[model samples]
Target: MTSLTCDVAVIGAGTAGLAAERNARKHGARTLLIDPEFAGTTCATVGCMPSKLLIAAARAAHQARESDLFGIRTGPVEVDGPAVMARLRRERDRFVSATRKDFDALPEGTRIRARARFDGLAGRLSGGQARLILDDERVVTARAVVIATGSAPMVPGPFAALGDLALTNETLFDLPDLPRSLAVIGGGAIGLELAQALARLGVSVTLFDSGTRLGGVRCDRIHATLKKAMAEEMTLRLGVTPEPSKDGRAERIAWEDGEATFDRVLVAAGRPPNVAGLGLETTGLRLDDHGMPEVDPRTMQCGDAPIFMAGDANGARPVLHEASAEGAIAGRNAVAWPAVVPSRRKTPFTITFTDPPLVSIGEDPDDSAAIGSADYGNQGRARVEGRNRGLARLYAAAPDGRLIGADLFCPGADHLGHLLVWAMEAGQTATDLLTRPTYHPTLEEGLRGALRQICRAVPLELPGDSDPGQPPGL
Candidate 1:
């Protein structure tokens, strides 16, 4: 077998691996990035870009249908499923091509187009080193390793038996035509987003969530609003699990209350880390209950091993931005191993991009000292757009008005979530955010309304609030 050596080896060429490789090189370390499939990043390939493309088309169709409310009538709208899928593929390929260009521009010999597995230790190196066995009969000895293998969509064992009849993110984007009917078997972000999108685009979709709630919104007011909005788009089967069985030439997903057979079953259950066949035993690292490497969340370093796990591979924070941040931490720490430098995690920001999207930011509002809310039913922009169907809640410490958390279920929420994410990260108070100018008749005004509630409820006493238009001393 041919042999190669590097200071660091990064497994997987997805977002996390690429970030890790770039940061390791920045730190003056010789790095080898490895992945069997150099197709593109997951977000570009299937996760985010393609899904959004489908959603955009679906929204256009839904909007056209709903335009009658505004006295704008476009009659007899028909959806051509095959044509829609074709356009989706074409646009998705452009994004994938762009990502591939970024990968191709990496320095020569930096990326290896092969799968890798741990091959025990390299005794020759003075410090602890790992031996990586490549599929092409090549070996690499690296002083430190970063596992960024990303993840795969989690399909239940029974669903796996359906083969081509069942679809996950890995296979969903590749379909040449849309299915007539679909059973979406998870009520998380992916499931709800796709279910609603497909339903809007003329596909019959039934969404089932085993849990009592949908998304992660803990507020009853917001959750009820989201559930109502999504229910109008697709059949909702909340607090129920579907029993799956394969019948001749058809698949059936039956629940206690009802049953349905569909042309396809889309599983948005969860993602399992791509840890299989990596030979973690050879690296002397024990896998956690989730079959993920037990790595420090801040450092991304695997336990007691000269290795690190980042991004979806660690199975903690799986979003694109979080993956990138984790990759940088893992990369830097891998280069400066034995002496650890941990980084502080940023304030958590997660958004589910269904219509009137669900957003979770910062701390848990359920445990907050005080909670305040704004109902979008009265917001000007929402009323003008005929989408006034959600609410925004702000959590803060009472008496001090320190912003702790914020949740929203409102139109244009993806953008709205970012504002709160920044504010909470910068330690802005509810009253402080209220001082910022809010554009009249915009969705952002809803944030101002929510902040005002928090300010009123907590009543933070600022020096100037006692006497308006006068200096505090005067």
Candidate 2:
């Protein structure tokens, strides 16, 4: 049997694993990256990039259909399903190819295209090294190991019985053409985005979730607004648990009150960590009931061992940027070993790329003094563009009116979320933000209006009365 040794060995070559491997090498440690398939990252290959490509196409078709509201009449907005899928695949391949190039550019002999598992018998050696058994019968020992194997989509048993009729994000983009009708089985970010995109692409979409909430939105006002906007496009069956069964060539989704048949079911159910076959029992570390090691978010270390867990595998923050940051921390600590230092994490930010996107940044204070809100129903830009149909709320701490968190379900939410996150991170207060100039007929005006509301509630003393009269272009 072949044997290999390295200072750091990273398992799984996804975003987190790649970041860990790169950072370990940057720290002057001999690092090895292992993955059964070095195709690309989850984001580029299946998660973000490809999904966005489909959303982009759907946006184009939607805009064309809605152009009539702007006093411009157009012919029937026809979406060529095959053509859309073709472009999505073409562009998605480019992204995947780029990621593969990055993997190929790694130092020769450092990238191993093999599956690896912990050596159950050896565990951790007395020298603080861990042994890994590769699929090719090669044994590798490393001073520190980082597990970034990522996660896999969870398909319930009933849906699994439907065979190929059930699709997950990993396989949805491979469809040659869009299905006639689709039932999305989750109301989180993935389900909301794909259901809307498919609906806009002329597919009959019915979205179901056991809970009434959509996208895990914290604010009730934002949830209500988002649900209304989404309902205008497709059927939303919230607060219902659906049972899937075979109905000839199609799938039948029956709930407490109603039953419907769809060409296919898109399972946006949560993805658990892909840790089943990694042989974690052999790691000589304590594992939780779910087989996850207790990882320190600040240090990314698994217990006191020289092993680390990052990204989705840890089930902390599953976002791409968070995964990358955690991987870096794990990699650096893996190289530093016993002298690992804790790293600070960024403000929590999440966005669902729906029509009027849903975004949440930072944590909502438990005892918020005031909540500033803006309604898009009559916002100048929203009314002018004929695309506005949502709400935005900014939370403030008591007394000082410090901007603590924000939940937005409105146009330019993606941009507004970033701005609010930066402001919160910089410790900006409501009165402090109100001092900034807001452009005329822009989405920032909505944020400014919300900030003004906060100032009113807290009665903060400012350099000048920032709550000026709203003029058309002022």
lDDT (Cα, tens digit) per residue for candidate 1, span 1-474: 799999999999999999999999999999999999898999998899999999999998999999999999899789998888899999999999999987888999998999999988654235778999999989999989999999999898989999899999879888988898999989888988899899988899988889978886778888899888988878889889798888776789989888889888999999879999998877666766655667898899888677989998888878999999999999999999867698999988888889978898886654446677777886777888999878888888766888877788888888988888788778889778766666666888776656666766777643245423211211
Error of 1 at 468 (Å): 13
lDDT top scorer: 2
Tens digits of lDDT, candidate 2, 1-474: 999999999998999999999999999999999999998999999999999999999999999998888788998998999999999999999999999988878999999999999985243435468889999999999999999999999999999999999999999999999999999999999999999999999999999999998899888888888888889999999999899999899999999999999999999989999999899898778988999889998999988888999998898889999999999999999999878999988888998999888899887567646888888778888878886678899988888888888898888999989989999889889888877777777887877777878888887765464557345432
* Regions more than 4 Å wrong, model 1: 122-126, 366-368, 462-474
- Candidate-wise lDDT, in order: 0.85, 0.90
Model 1 Cα shift for residue 218 (angstroms): 2.5
TM-score of 2: 0.96
Candidate 1: Cα lDDT at 20: 93
Q: Candidate 1: give the clashing pairs.
A: none
